[model samples]
Target: MIVMNDSQYHQLVDDAFERIEQTMDSDDFDIECDINGGVLTLEFENRSKMVINKQEPLHQLWLATKFGGYHFEWHEAEQQWICNRSGNEFWSLLVESITKQSGEELSF
Candidate 1:
Protein backbone atom coordinates (compact mmCIF):
# COMPACT_ATOMS: atom_id res chain seq x y z
CA MET A 1 0.00 0.00 0.00
CA ILE A 2 1.17 3.50 -0.74
CA VAL A 3 0.00 5.90 1.90
CA MET A 4 -0.71 9.02 -0.11
CA ASN A 5 -0.38 12.46 1.36
CA ASP A 6 -3.38 14.79 1.13
CA SER A 7 -1.93 16.73 -1.77
CA GLN A 8 -1.10 13.64 -3.78
CA TYR A 9 -4.46 12.05 -3.05
CA HIS A 10 -6.31 15.17 -4.07
CA GLN A 11 -4.40 15.45 -7.32
CA LEU A 12 -4.93 11.81 -8.16
CA VAL A 13 -8.67 11.99 -7.61
CA ASP A 14 -8.96 15.34 -9.27
CA ASP A 15 -7.27 14.05 -12.39
CA ALA A 16 -9.30 10.86 -12.41
CA PHE A 17 -12.62 12.66 -12.41
CA GLU A 18 -11.46 15.05 -15.08
CA ARG A 19 -10.70 12.17 -17.38
CA ILE A 20 -13.98 10.47 -16.54
CA GLU A 21 -15.89 13.64 -17.31
CA GLN A 22 -14.21 14.10 -20.66
CA THR A 23 -14.84 10.52 -21.68
CA MET A 24 -18.42 10.31 -20.51
CA ASP A 25 -19.74 13.61 -21.74
CA SER A 26 -22.42 12.85 -24.34
CA ASP A 27 -25.09 14.82 -26.15
CA ASP A 28 -27.93 12.78 -24.73
CA PHE A 29 -27.31 13.83 -21.17
CA ASP A 30 -24.38 14.95 -19.12
CA ILE A 31 -23.26 13.09 -16.06
CA GLU A 32 -22.78 15.84 -13.56
CA CYS A 33 -19.37 15.58 -11.95
CA ASP A 34 -18.76 18.02 -9.15
CA ILE A 35 -16.00 18.44 -6.64
CA ASN A 36 -16.46 20.32 -3.41
CA GLY A 37 -13.52 20.27 -1.05
CA GLY A 38 -12.34 16.65 -1.23
CA VAL A 39 -15.66 15.06 -2.15
CA LEU A 40 -16.52 14.20 -5.75
CA THR A 41 -20.16 13.65 -6.56
CA LEU A 42 -21.38 12.14 -9.83
CA GLU A 43 -25.04 12.62 -10.55
CA PHE A 44 -26.92 10.53 -13.07
CA GLU A 45 -30.04 11.52 -14.92
CA ASN A 46 -32.18 9.49 -12.54
CA ARG A 47 -31.13 11.73 -9.68
CA SER A 48 -29.09 8.91 -8.22
CA LYS A 49 -25.52 9.62 -7.18
CA MET A 50 -22.13 8.07 -6.63
CA VAL A 51 -20.00 9.87 -4.08
CA ILE A 52 -16.22 9.63 -3.86
CA ASN A 53 -14.01 11.30 -1.31
CA LYS A 54 -10.65 11.11 0.34
CA GLN A 55 -10.23 9.85 3.88
CA GLU A 56 -7.26 11.90 4.95
CA PRO A 57 -6.73 10.24 8.30
CA LEU A 58 -6.71 6.77 6.73
CA HIS A 59 -5.01 7.71 3.47
CA GLN A 60 -7.80 6.08 1.52
CA LEU A 61 -10.46 6.94 -1.00
CA TRP A 62 -14.04 6.16 -0.06
CA LEU A 63 -16.89 5.56 -2.47
CA ALA A 64 -20.59 5.36 -1.71
CA THR A 65 -23.25 4.02 -4.03
CA LYS A 66 -26.83 2.95 -3.57
CA PHE A 67 -25.70 -0.64 -3.33
CA GLY A 68 -22.88 -0.27 -0.81
CA GLY A 69 -19.82 1.59 0.39
CA TYR A 70 -16.25 0.78 -0.64
CA HIS A 71 -12.84 2.06 0.44
CA PHE A 72 -9.72 2.15 -1.71
CA GLU A 73 -6.07 2.72 -1.01
CA TRP A 74 -3.25 3.71 -3.32
CA HIS A 75 -1.26 0.83 -4.75
CA GLU A 76 2.15 2.08 -5.72
CA ALA A 77 3.35 -1.07 -7.44
CA GLU A 78 0.32 -1.33 -9.73
CA GLN A 79 0.03 2.40 -10.20
CA GLN A 80 -3.61 2.21 -9.30
CA TRP A 81 -6.04 2.75 -6.53
CA ILE A 82 -7.33 -0.57 -5.26
CA CYS A 83 -10.14 -1.39 -2.91
CA ASN A 84 -8.91 -2.12 0.56
CA ARG A 85 -11.20 -5.11 0.98
CA SER A 86 -11.84 -6.37 -2.55
CA GLY A 87 -8.74 -5.26 -4.40
CA ASN A 88 -10.86 -3.99 -7.29
CA GLU A 89 -9.31 -1.11 -9.13
CA PHE A 90 -10.87 2.28 -8.56
CA TRP A 91 -11.71 3.05 -12.20
CA SER A 92 -13.37 -0.32 -12.71
CA LEU A 93 -15.51 0.20 -9.64
CA LEU A 94 -16.51 3.64 -10.82
CA VAL A 95 -17.44 2.33 -14.25
CA GLU A 96 -19.44 -0.51 -12.77
CA SER A 97 -21.16 1.89 -10.42
CA ILE A 98 -22.14 4.21 -13.23
CA THR A 99 -23.40 1.36 -15.39
CA LYS A 100 -25.46 -0.05 -12.56
CA GLN A 101 -26.96 3.29 -11.65
CA SER A 102 -27.48 4.73 -15.12
CA GLY A 103 -27.73 1.71 -17.46
CA GLU A 104 -24.83 3.09 -19.48
CA GLU A 105 -21.30 1.87 -19.95
CA LEU A 106 -18.50 4.28 -19.13
CA SER A 107 -14.83 3.76 -19.74
CA PHE A 108 -12.06 5.55 -17.86
Candidate 2:
Protein backbone atom coordinates (compact mmCIF):
# COMPACT_ATOMS: atom_id res chain seq x y z
CA MET A 1 0.00 0.00 0.00
CA ILE A 2 1.19 3.48 -0.74
CA VAL A 3 1.88 5.45 2.39
CA MET A 4 -0.31 8.50 2.90
CA ASN A 5 -0.41 10.96 5.73
CA ASP A 6 -3.61 10.99 7.72
CA SER A 7 -4.87 14.22 6.23
CA GLN A 8 -4.36 13.06 2.66
CA TYR A 9 -6.04 9.74 3.38
CA HIS A 10 -9.01 11.43 4.96
CA GLN A 11 -9.34 13.96 2.18
CA LEU A 12 -9.27 11.29 -0.52
CA VAL A 13 -11.90 9.17 1.16
CA ASP A 14 -14.04 12.24 1.75
CA ASP A 15 -13.75 13.25 -1.86
CA ALA A 16 -14.65 9.78 -3.10
CA PHE A 17 -17.78 9.59 -0.99
CA GLU A 18 -18.78 13.11 -1.94
CA ARG A 19 -18.62 12.06 -5.56
CA ILE A 20 -20.85 9.12 -4.81
CA GLU A 21 -23.23 11.41 -2.95
CA GLN A 22 -23.32 13.79 -5.88
CA THR A 23 -24.09 10.95 -8.23
CA MET A 24 -27.02 9.93 -6.07
CA ASP A 25 -28.23 13.48 -5.80
CA SER A 26 -28.10 14.29 -9.51
CA ASP A 27 -29.53 10.99 -10.73
CA ASP A 28 -32.19 10.53 -8.07
CA PHE A 29 -31.00 7.13 -6.92
CA ASP A 30 -32.91 5.56 -4.04
CA ILE A 31 -29.92 5.57 -1.72
CA GLU A 32 -29.79 8.02 1.15
CA CYS A 33 -26.49 8.76 2.86
CA ASP A 34 -25.41 10.17 6.17
CA ILE A 35 -21.83 10.67 7.32
CA ASN A 36 -20.90 11.03 10.95
CA GLY A 37 -17.68 10.52 12.82
CA GLY A 38 -15.95 9.57 9.59
CA VAL A 39 -18.44 6.85 8.82
CA LEU A 40 -20.82 6.99 5.88
CA THR A 41 -24.11 5.10 6.04
CA LEU A 42 -26.04 4.50 2.86
CA GLU A 43 -29.63 3.42 3.29
CA PHE A 44 -31.65 2.07 0.44
CA GLU A 45 -35.36 2.34 -0.19
CA ASN A 46 -35.69 -1.39 0.49
CA ARG A 47 -34.21 -0.75 3.92
CA SER A 48 -30.90 -2.52 3.46
CA LYS A 49 -27.80 -0.49 4.12
CA MET A 50 -24.09 -0.22 3.40
CA VAL A 51 -21.58 1.53 5.60
CA ILE A 52 -18.15 2.88 4.77
CA ASN A 53 -15.78 3.80 7.52
CA LYS A 54 -12.27 5.12 7.72
CA GLN A 55 -9.47 3.22 9.41
CA GLU A 56 -6.93 5.87 10.20
CA PRO A 57 -4.51 3.63 12.02
CA LEU A 58 -4.17 1.27 9.11
CA HIS A 59 -4.65 3.90 6.46
CA GLN A 60 -7.46 1.83 5.00
CA LEU A 61 -11.12 2.30 4.23
CA TRP A 62 -13.61 -0.33 5.27
CA LEU A 63 -16.91 -1.17 3.63
CA ALA A 64 -19.66 -3.17 5.28
CA THR A 65 -22.71 -4.62 3.60
CA LYS A 66 -25.04 -7.56 4.14
CA PHE A 67 -22.71 -9.81 2.21
CA GLY A 68 -19.51 -9.09 4.09
CA GLY A 69 -16.86 -6.55 4.90
CA TYR A 70 -14.15 -5.23 2.61
CA HIS A 71 -10.92 -3.39 3.24
CA PHE A 72 -9.69 -0.95 0.63
CA GLU A 73 -6.33 0.72 0.39
CA TRP A 74 -5.31 3.66 -1.71
CA HIS A 75 -3.97 2.64 -5.09
CA GLU A 76 -1.95 5.67 -6.08
CA ALA A 77 -1.15 4.49 -9.58
CA GLU A 78 -4.81 3.73 -10.30
CA GLN A 79 -6.01 6.83 -8.49
CA GLN A 80 -8.77 4.84 -6.81
CA TRP A 81 -9.50 2.57 -3.91
CA ILE A 82 -8.67 -1.07 -4.47
CA CYS A 83 -9.89 -3.89 -2.28
CA ASN A 84 -7.00 -5.44 -0.44
CA ARG A 85 -8.14 -9.01 -0.97
CA SER A 86 -10.11 -8.99 -4.22
CA GLY A 87 -8.46 -6.11 -6.01
CA ASN A 88 -11.85 -4.80 -7.09
CA GLU A 89 -12.40 -1.13 -7.62
CA PHE A 90 -14.16 0.50 -4.71
CA TRP A 91 -16.87 2.01 -6.91
CA SER A 92 -17.65 -1.26 -8.65
CA LEU A 93 -17.77 -3.24 -5.43
CA LEU A 94 -20.01 -0.66 -3.83
CA VAL A 95 -22.38 -0.63 -6.77
CA GLU A 96 -22.56 -4.42 -6.66
CA SER A 97 -23.27 -4.43 -2.95
CA ILE A 98 -26.04 -1.84 -3.21
CA THR A 99 -27.64 -3.52 -6.19
CA LYS A 100 -27.61 -6.92 -4.55
CA GLN A 101 -29.02 -5.61 -1.30
CA SER A 102 -31.56 -3.14 -2.67
CA GLY A 103 -32.39 -4.74 -6.00
CA GLU A 104 -31.76 -1.38 -7.59
CA GLU A 105 -29.07 -0.76 -10.14
CA LEU A 106 -26.75 2.06 -9.10
CA SER A 107 -24.41 3.93 -11.40
CA PHE A 108 -21.97 4.96 -8.71
Candidate 3:
Protein backbone atom coordinates (compact mmCIF):
# COMPACT_ATOMS: atom_id res chain seq x y z
CA MET A 1 0.00 0.00 0.00
CA ILE A 2 1.20 3.47 -0.81
CA VAL A 3 0.87 5.57 2.28
CA MET A 4 0.07 9.22 1.65
CA ASN A 5 -0.18 12.27 3.80
CA ASP A 6 -3.52 13.97 4.43
CA SER A 7 -2.60 16.92 2.25
CA GLN A 8 -1.93 14.62 -0.69
CA TYR A 9 -5.24 12.84 -0.27
CA HIS A 10 -7.06 16.14 -0.04
CA GLN A 11 -5.25 17.34 -3.12
CA LEU A 12 -6.54 14.31 -5.03
CA VAL A 13 -10.10 14.98 -3.92
CA ASP A 14 -9.85 18.65 -4.84
CA ASP A 15 -8.56 17.72 -8.27
CA ALA A 16 -11.59 15.52 -8.84
CA PHE A 17 -13.85 18.46 -8.07
CA GLU A 18 -11.93 20.68 -10.40
CA ARG A 19 -12.42 18.17 -13.20
CA ILE A 20 -16.16 18.22 -12.68
CA GLU A 21 -16.27 21.98 -12.74
CA GLN A 22 -14.42 22.02 -16.02
CA THR A 23 -16.43 19.29 -17.73
CA MET A 24 -19.99 19.83 -16.60
CA ASP A 25 -22.25 22.65 -17.62
CA SER A 26 -24.69 22.13 -14.78
CA ASP A 27 -24.64 23.32 -11.21
CA ASP A 28 -21.58 22.82 -9.10
CA PHE A 29 -21.17 19.61 -7.15
CA ASP A 30 -19.53 18.95 -3.83
CA ILE A 31 -17.41 16.00 -2.77
CA GLU A 32 -16.63 14.97 0.76
CA CYS A 33 -13.86 12.42 1.02
CA ASP A 34 -13.00 10.54 4.13
CA ILE A 35 -9.72 8.73 3.62
CA ASN A 36 -9.87 6.87 6.92
CA GLY A 37 -13.18 5.28 5.91
CA GLY A 38 -12.19 4.91 2.26
CA VAL A 39 -15.33 6.62 1.03
CA LEU A 40 -16.20 9.55 -1.21
CA THR A 41 -19.58 11.21 -1.16
CA LEU A 42 -20.59 13.24 -4.19
CA GLU A 43 -23.59 15.51 -3.99
CA PHE A 44 -25.03 16.71 -7.27
CA GLU A 45 -27.12 19.80 -7.82
CA ASN A 46 -30.17 18.04 -9.28
CA ARG A 47 -30.06 15.41 -6.56
CA SER A 48 -28.55 12.77 -8.84
CA LYS A 49 -26.88 9.90 -7.07
CA MET A 50 -23.61 8.24 -8.09
CA VAL A 51 -21.94 5.73 -5.84
CA ILE A 52 -18.42 4.46 -6.52
CA ASN A 53 -17.61 0.89 -5.49
CA LYS A 54 -13.98 0.71 -4.52
CA GLN A 55 -14.06 -2.53 -2.58
CA GLU A 56 -12.16 -4.69 -5.04
CA PRO A 57 -8.52 -4.49 -6.14
CA LEU A 58 -7.66 -4.31 -2.42
CA HIS A 59 -4.56 -2.18 -2.66
CA GLN A 60 -6.36 0.98 -3.83
CA LEU A 61 -9.62 2.60 -4.87
CA TRP A 62 -10.05 5.07 -7.75
CA LEU A 63 -13.25 6.94 -8.66
CA ALA A 64 -13.92 9.64 -11.23
CA THR A 65 -17.02 11.83 -11.48
CA LYS A 66 -18.23 12.76 -14.92
CA PHE A 67 -21.21 13.93 -16.91
CA GLY A 68 -24.39 11.84 -17.48
CA GLY A 69 -24.04 9.92 -14.25
CA TYR A 70 -21.32 7.47 -15.21
CA HIS A 71 -18.89 5.65 -12.92
CA PHE A 72 -15.49 4.05 -13.55
CA GLU A 73 -13.19 1.57 -11.86
CA TRP A 74 -9.46 1.14 -11.62
CA HIS A 75 -7.65 -1.84 -13.14
CA GLU A 76 -4.51 -2.43 -11.13
CA ALA A 77 -2.93 -5.01 -13.41
CA GLU A 78 -3.48 -2.93 -16.54
CA GLN A 79 -2.29 0.18 -14.76
CA GLN A 80 -5.36 1.90 -16.15
CA TRP A 81 -8.95 2.67 -15.26
CA ILE A 82 -12.04 1.25 -16.94
CA CYS A 83 -15.67 2.22 -17.09
CA ASN A 84 -17.20 -1.22 -16.57
CA ARG A 85 -20.63 0.30 -16.11
CA SER A 86 -20.37 1.82 -19.58
CA GLY A 87 -18.11 -0.84 -21.13
CA ASN A 88 -15.25 1.49 -21.94
CA GLU A 89 -11.60 1.96 -21.03
CA PHE A 90 -11.19 5.40 -19.48
CA TRP A 91 -9.40 7.53 -16.95
CA SER A 92 -10.04 7.83 -13.21
CA LEU A 93 -10.02 11.05 -11.24
CA LEU A 94 -9.71 9.28 -7.91
CA VAL A 95 -6.28 9.47 -6.33
CA GLU A 96 -6.02 6.84 -3.62
CA SER A 97 -2.95 6.08 -1.62
CA ILE A 98 -2.58 3.97 1.52
CA THR A 99 -5.50 4.27 3.94
CA LYS A 100 -3.42 4.92 6.98
CA GLN A 101 -2.88 8.42 8.35
CA SER A 102 0.40 9.52 9.82
CA GLY A 103 0.54 10.64 13.48
CA GLU A 104 0.32 14.30 12.48
CA GLU A 105 -2.06 13.87 9.57
CA LEU A 106 -4.86 12.51 11.73
CA SER A 107 -7.01 15.06 13.47
CA PHE A 108 -9.14 13.80 16.29
Using lDDT as the measure, the top candidate is 2
Local distance difference test, each candidate: 0.81, 0.88, 0.38
| lDDT of the structure predicted as candidate 1 | 0.81
Looking at model 3, residue 51 earns an lDDT score of 37
Each prediction's TM-score against the native? 0.86, 0.93, 0.33
Best by TM-score: 2
Candidate 2 weakest lDDT stretch, 10 residues? 19-28
Residue pair clashes in candidate 3: none
- For candidate 3, the 10 contiguous residues with the lowest summed lDDT are 97-106
Total backbone clashes of candidate 1, pairs 3 or more residues apart or in separate chains? 0
lDDT of 1 by residue, 1-108 (tens): 876678887787777767766775653445787778878788888899989887878878899999999998888899888998888999899889889988877576
Taking all chains together, the TM-score of candidate 3 against the true structure is 0.33
Q: What is the C-alpha lDDT profile of model 2 across 1-108, one tens digit per residue?
A: 688898999899889879877887888687798888889998999888899999989989899999999999998999989999999999999888888998878686
